[model samples]
Target: MNTLGVTLVLGLLLGVWAQTNIERPQCDSPEAEEAALVAQDYLNAEHTQGYKFALNRIEDIKIYTKPDGDKTYKLEVELLETDCHVLDPTPLVNCTVRPKMMTAVEGDCDVVLKRVGGVLTVTAFKCKTEESTEDICLGCSTLLPLNDTTALDFVHKSLASFNNFNENVTYAVFEVGRMSSQVVSGGLVYLAEYVVVEANCTEDPCVPLNDAMAARGICTAKGSSIAHSVNCQMFLTMMPVIDANVVDVNSTVAVTNSTSAVAPALPPMVHVHTGSLSPKLGLRYHKLTTLHNPELSGLLSAESTESDEVVPVAPGVANSTAPADAGSDSSNSAEVPVVVKKRDVPIVPVVPAPAVVDPIAVVPVCPGRKRFF
Candidate 1:
């Protein structure tokens, strides 16, 4: 064989040996933990809706060191749903995992992180959640995740059709609890069970439901493109003129077609007493913790009300109300007294400017990362 041919073969064998000998990092290592935490934070920040998630466990970790001193880490992380919603702004440390009785949701994510110059950043991540199997029928209907786009579309269309059929009250979709799909001869049939809150107006462009209102109902819809049907039972809260306890007025609306019906009497204004609201409403009113930067907290608290007024003082002198030349011995050695004038200005608290954060840098997906969804 020629010398060139032997050299090429030797180089190929060395490359294969190096590739096979790559080391896998421990899942509990510091680098792996840091990458997982970064990926979790990115997911929480990017997920604008639904409940927030907390890291349950790290499944796998792989680290690849580059020739330029950079390292890429791929992590498979499992996350559990927390009681706090995404809009609560509560720190993950304070959030508790939802119990299984409450239909807890869990997800697995494939995250890729790259460290350059000792700084780690998440490049790409994708998560898939397990669908609920409670009451799922075999070969009849398939349950889908609550975040599925197609199920959500079906929910919106069903709600719109419901509002059009019922002329008594305009209901808006508050939350979609469960959904399932079935294959029929005509087309696909979608079934959605959702909660609806009473909207302020009674038309297509009605105002959104008020947070303080306790009037809500449950609805179940089943249909396809050919036809749809919705049945809703709403409980309206009513405050009696003499009774102390609130009363619930029940109303039912059933529609099998999209045809409009006669308008019924509007329900009275709902007056819910304190501590009697629904659990879902209580979740919406959770007290959010204020998150402040530790480095800027002192500056923010030390802000002076007289920021616009500047009082220049001498380098080694204390503030005083005495005359500028009161303690003068010689004409050249006069003591200057800094007078602080008191004004009757109202002290207004100043709001601190929002801190600017650098955007996360993203790079191409690493070859070591594989999605397991």
Candidate 2:
């Protein structure tokens, strides 16, 4: 062979050897190292939530070089969570958070991450709204047998909107029946804690949710007649001035029950239907009439006056005594006979005669007519 041919063959062999060495390092180098570090940090963070995400696999390395001799590599990797599992019962009100950690760079080595197994997402509240509030301590005195299942849910019932401050909270209260030896017709003794629900009125400030009013009726089962109720349930209707703790400082809800034999009975106003009128009864007078006399009736009518002399009693009338003066002597007066006419049966309250008294006895004991004080 010629000297030139031998030289050309050696140069080609040297070029191929250099290409193989450069490609070997490109498959695994600095960029892959940095990605591995990031994956490690992510796994460490996942461990805090009781899960461990470890790198499963990596592949597909491709290297490219520019005129400036700058090289880049592309790759893929897979990962999986090692230990923890989460179960979610409700999806709407719950959220799922998953660990996300992966990075890519242009350099000698490239790392690709592929997720091997599915992640078990733990469910939690992303947002919760405040609904209502109640002040049960004031009116609730005794506990009653409560059917816990009867309680209504705020969201499902649409009773009231929850405020932003009352999210992700669980609260409850108990009701007891009053104990008494007396056999009351209805079970009257009962106590309950008042719960308050505020309306999320950002849209309609004046009104509350449709279920707000009906909600309490369901809670206490007392619609309009707390008077007959052995138990009462009430919900706060006012928009209370909330404190830093999201509780009302001065606002309260009033609870009432009728069958209670407790110290504090239902207020009198609650019994207004019973027709209690002592306060106004004193202002009225009893009406009286006597044989409907035309003359006496005339005096009560629009025309007669005291100056008009009273007529004498009729001849057949048994009570013919003369009309006495305003202050007359009655001991010397003779009694008059009264005759009562009977009805198909008999009449009642036969009008009594006006009683007369001696004027001198009632007057202060003045000295003899001639004497001076």
TM-score of each: 0.40, 0.17
Candidate 1 ranges beyond 4 A from true positions: 1-23, 132-205, 208-247, 250-373
Clash pairs detected, candidate 1:
none
Worst 10 residues of 1 by lDDT: 335-344
Error at 167, model 1, angstroms: 23
Q: Per-residue lDDT of 1-373 in model 1, one digit per residue for the tens? A: 6999878865654343233212245566666678888978878887654557778777665554534455656566777777555645457888887555434566666665667778888764545554333543444665555556676666665566555545556766666555668887867878766666667663435554767554566567777523566666553421211111101112333434324445354432222212322243313211111122222111111111112332333422211111122211211112111100111122543522223221111221222322221
lDDT of each: 0.49, 0.24
Q: Pick the candidate with the highest lDDT.
A: 1
